[model samples]
Target chain A: MSEEKRIKVLLAKLGVEVHWRGVITVAGMLRDAGMEVVYIGNAFPPEIIETAIQEGVDVIGVSTLGGNHLTLGGELLELAKQKGVKDSMVFVIGGVFPPYDIPKLKDVGFDGIFGPGATQEEIVGFIKDAVSKKLGK
Target chain B: MSEEKTTKQILQEAEEKRKAERVPLYNPEALKQIKEKFDQWYNTKLREEDRKNWFVTPQTILGSEIPRGLLYTPLDVADLDYMQDIGFSGDEPYTRGIHPNMYRGRLFTVRQLAGFGGPEDTNERIKFLLAHGATGINIVFDLPTIQMYDSDDPMARGQVGWCGVAMDTVKDWEILFDGIPIDKISVSLVTHYPTNTAILFAMYLVMAERRGIPWDKLIGTVQNDIIMEEVVRSGAEYLPPKWVFKNQCDNIEFIRKNVPRWNFITYNGYNLREAGTSGVTEMAVAFTNAIDTLKELTGRGHDVDWICERLAFFWDPSMDFFEEVCRLRAARRLWYKIMKHQFNAKSPRSMWMRCHVQTSGISLTREEPLNNIVRAAYEALAAVLGGAQSMHVDSYDEAYSVPTEAAALVSVRTQQIIQAETGVTEVVDPLGGSFYVEWLTNEIEGRILDEIDEMQRLGGIVKVIETGWIHKKIADYAYKEQRKIEEGIIKIAGLNYFRAADVKLPEIDVFRYPEGVEERQRKKLQKIREERDNKEVQARLDELTRAARRGEPIIEYCIECARAMCTEGEMFKALKEAWGTWRPPAYW
Candidate 1:
């Protein structure tokens, strides 16, 4: 029997989102929940996805409160595909996104979308499920 | 009793009776009976149903979930002395208020924080606000300007005009206040330290001089409160803490001698509250910061009365109604005692706590953004009842973006409606004699006093900041508050609880600066550089560096540089050459 792999996630802030409180809180919570979480503070979308690919992270979680999530989120997915890591890596977003943008976010191939009131448990559970499903577990 | 009682005994009995009468209308025995009946009802009738249907969370004030009594009576506040603690308004230890007839005589100054994009954009907003009856102008600067960077710096990309107006040179200031008169309008530069403020102050002086306004006639406030910035916000230490202090003291001392009408430093606790501190922490930190600054100034042979009299405060009035009100009242009383007892200040003006309040931006919600208007209204009402000297209402769309002009106007109207239509301004300290408010005031006062004492014991505010003690406290509270919200312990309507399904998301018109604002700002700086006398600019910068190195007051030198048409970045570079910049200790 193969042993279960610990889910490796990379969390980053996209495009000048200087509100670090949410990103810091989510990083700490995910780390305590037994996941290998790498936080790349704040960077451009392409730079963030490059770090995800380099770190071999199974999930890329982008945190933003700057209202540029739609444009940046779409660019991140496109960059991941160009880098040939789309099937291997799952994309997730968490921050202050309006309810109207949820369907659009999912349509852009995000595995999960966490808004303002998402709990740590919900995030951990979703990340675990998404990673395992991607690995064909 | 039959024997003749002594004269002292009669006086003591009268004093006791007066103390007992200061509490609620009910006597102690009656209050006890009411509490007993409430307990019985809570246990037998309310407890079972509360458990079955509704989860009873603790009623908290600013994240301290201590249980409060259902009602308070004379018993709760019998120890308070009316003469010493709860004196009349405009009297010694002014707990009720600093003015005799606060709102009835004059309403608080309605100042909206208006700034975004270029100088022309902010200038238009200021004119609009003034036309709508705004009494003061609170100017917000862009991140680059606040960080002491030029607009053309590579580090300032994408952030030049997004947060606030991008100001790089004296020309920007001239355009910022184009048609507005400096003497009539009270302007506050909501900028930070350690050198940005000095540069901004120099620009203001240069502008006034160009317009033939005297130094003493210029009226405004520059938020040179670098202590709170070090403690809570971006831990960006432009220079070492001691250097920052020296620069701030230079401004205070220079302004005291030259510009008597301008407030040199406004100790801001609003950032602390926004960073998730309790009311007690906010009050304690602000007081400690002010006390430390006064001590430094006095040690330098400046009069304690002069510094204390000119000092002002900026606070955040959150959604907790009574607690917010009590926080301001207790702050006034505590500042009065601090000035009189600790500093031995004799001027009554020195003892009065003059404060400006901004409604809490942390309380605004991104879910139903319109609900923020209601939140701001209640907070503004609390600030009014708490006796603020000036107030700024946060725009409803602040959660999503920098407020559009429409949203900013609505925010100003929110305060206007409360000031004109609502009858809250008819009386001074309208909730003064309420039992719960009095008890809360006493409680908050005691807690803040204890924290201030602890800070003193921990080697004053500056030392605590250098050691990261207070920063740790803020971080711990912030994490706890976030956890409580995630756990559903703290219920925010439309966010955590009572969330609506199938809600139509409101289409907010987020303010977007015109493209190439940063490029235009850079071009303006270049034009000033090419048009001015380079030799004079270089000479002024060299003098500024020498004065900084020799520990001389550099405000005059800064004004010289401003007069020579030097850029902010050039002044900052000159100072950096004299005293190298500082890097804050790694926090987390």
Candidate 2:
């Protein structure tokens, strides 16, 4: 990608749990950072997220608040792995989870896990670092 | 004089003839401008992934379940009879409003759903809320207790004391209510199964006995509506339909005989709507379950009036303002009609549709936390105008964890402001005569009736649920609503439209689970296991099992087991062995 080409990211939510506030914050930060952004919206199963990734998004984020976080999150990771985009696209997970559940989240291959108190700068920096690692700029 | 036409006569004739002198369209032309602006702003023509951003299309809309309109007009409700259907405030049906004096002097209960740690932590929250002008308390049991598992059960690991307070036995109850006077305040719990809540209620009675408090002085609600739970949860897959009805009947019979003052069942459509089903679906499913409960109780010789007196409802007020108000009005009118015309209920209370409402939890966005407070305020007002008896506003931070103290306090303050500052309550049924409200109310009622009839043909709400009818409908709507939002059809402020800058909200006071709650609770259960008259516990369990088998009133037997220190899970397991667990069909 050229320096003039801004990284475009799409954030979406899957399942009945509809917590999108974190994704919105990240989207605003990315836009401020001069990156192209799109928010796909809530309650799409893993297939839709895969579609966004397939659409050549630079990064993909998904949020959930319902009880089935374990099942849905794991499915997204497996889908990403199967699609061979697991390493190419950064995957982030956020919403309500106990502190101890973070290790299990890491084990599931989420690139970043933003728990309850994360800020916009922290999330934006993580995305920037991932892009830098890939681009080696 | 020609003839005395009943309300039914008038309504039917009006529907067929459409002969009323036209009132200029009930909603002013401003609504059209709002719609035009909304469409222009939304750009529904585009395709998007966010359900919140997508536009709702005619083809994508659920064939039978969609809410007809966002803003209903007088034409939508032209056929409704004000006197017969709505009636006066506090009168029969109380459709317009429950009381002529609603909110004139008193405010609806300002209860916040709070639980973290163990009994002690919850007790402290309760004390704080009571002192802060919360008229009642709504309990949120941790996942362990909700699933009826004791602290020591393997299924309870990690989940104990997570979401709400954990209770293993009567002693947990003792500590949870340590200094609070139960009889003086209204209490409601978000529990569904009867066996556990019945035993818990019996223990509460025992606590009151020890405190020298009379049972009649107790006022509150126990959410023992098993059918509603089944429909709202994974489609009541655990228990057989026969057993589900039997458990509900047993609990109702027991509550009526033992705890006369408390509401026996708090039926919930709130969970269903929050699950993303339409408002019409919520009303239809709720009423269908209510009818099923009535059939079971009355078939067993319980008087309709007696059962109706204790029956109650729980609803979720979503973000659709006018639609929600009409939904509430429609609920009251429909329930009253069912009681008067169908069940022949003579008592006014039997016909009254008393409800408790919580704002739609799904409406809270995780992105812009502060914006949720505004959404909650609107939902709360909708519930109030719709005549909710009690309400709990969902804390904006619920998407994260148990609300911080500041969030909960602000939630409470939202209600206080509405009660004290806003003159909304000054006039009872303030929105009653509004052409839009009345029309929307009638349309909502009409749609609900049609849906309920459709569900009845499938053998009732339980069968409809057993067949996975409700879940499919909710999933379908959830999908379409998402598509519309993602496609820029409907713009959620924070998500789709006029995106705001990333803003930091004031820090909320977090409530942590009490330390040692699970360990302490497990120890208590262990002590009861060692110290309780073991033989007596066995005896009571045997008796309860036998009573359940014999189709006898099982509440008393369950209470006896509670007295002997039998755990909630053990009692539930015993019944599960007899009735089996319900599981929803996974067509997805």
Q: Evaluated with DockQ, which candidate comes out highest?
A: 1
Worst 10 residues of 2 chain B by lDDT: B55-64
RMSD of each: 7.0, 10.0
Off by over 4 Å in 1: A1-19, A36-137, B1-61, B235-237
Q: How accurate is candidate 1 locally (lDDT)?
A: 0.78
Chain A TM-score values for every predicted structure, listed in order: 0.93, 0.85
DockQ of each: 0.20, 0.07
What range of 10 consecutive residues in model 1 chain B has the weakest lDDT sum? B1-10
The residue-by-residue lDDT of candidate 2 on B436-480, one tens digit each, is 677667767888887877777677766776777776677656655
Instruction: Name the regions of candidate 2 deviating beyond 4 angstroms.
Output: A1-95, A98-137, B1-81, B234-237, B500-510
Residue B579 deviation, candidate 2, in Å? 2.1
lDDT of 2 at B339: 79
Instruction: Indicate the TM-score of model 1.
Output: 0.85
